[model samples]
Target: MEREFRICSECGKIMFEGYVIEGGWRYYCSDTCLEKNYTRDEFNEMYGDGDTETYYTEW
Candidate 1:
């Protein structure tokens, strides 16, 4: 038998079987989301203070 998965909620991209992790699947398109999750507070350090705002607006 085979299994199926849902698209990432934040990006509307399809997620494949192996991509899912133990607790649950990721919420966004790729490692982009994972990085953002771990380093949101440091966004200013990487891209400046208003960069996070720009990301949401562009999305």
Candidate 2:
């Protein structure tokens, strides 16, 4: 992993030690940010390939 500072996909915040990553594609700093962007079901319906394991990104 590069371990670089990633910008939140939803709030545009800097994620330092903690961040939510979806399928190594998009990043979220928190659950609030994730939900604000897309609900789990909604996200799955669109971007997900039916595997929800990658959804547990909150640290």
Top TM-score model? 2
Instruction: Identify the candidate with maximal lDDT.
Output: 2
For candidate 1, the 10 contiguous residues with the lowest summed lDDT are 50-59
Pairs of residues clashing in candidate 1? none
Please report, as a residue range, the 10-residue window in candidate 2 with the lowest summed lDDT.
50-59
lDDT of 1 by residue, 1-59 (tens): 65565566556776652122222434444657546454655533433454332222111
In order, the Cα lDDT scores of the candidates are 0.43, 0.64
RMSD of each candidate?
Answer: 11.0, 4.6
**For candidate 2, lDDT tens digit of each residue in 1-59?**
65667678877888764334455577877778878877777766654664653454333
- TM-score of decoy 2: 0.49
Which parts of model 2 are misplaced by more than 4 Å?
1-3, 18-21, 40-59
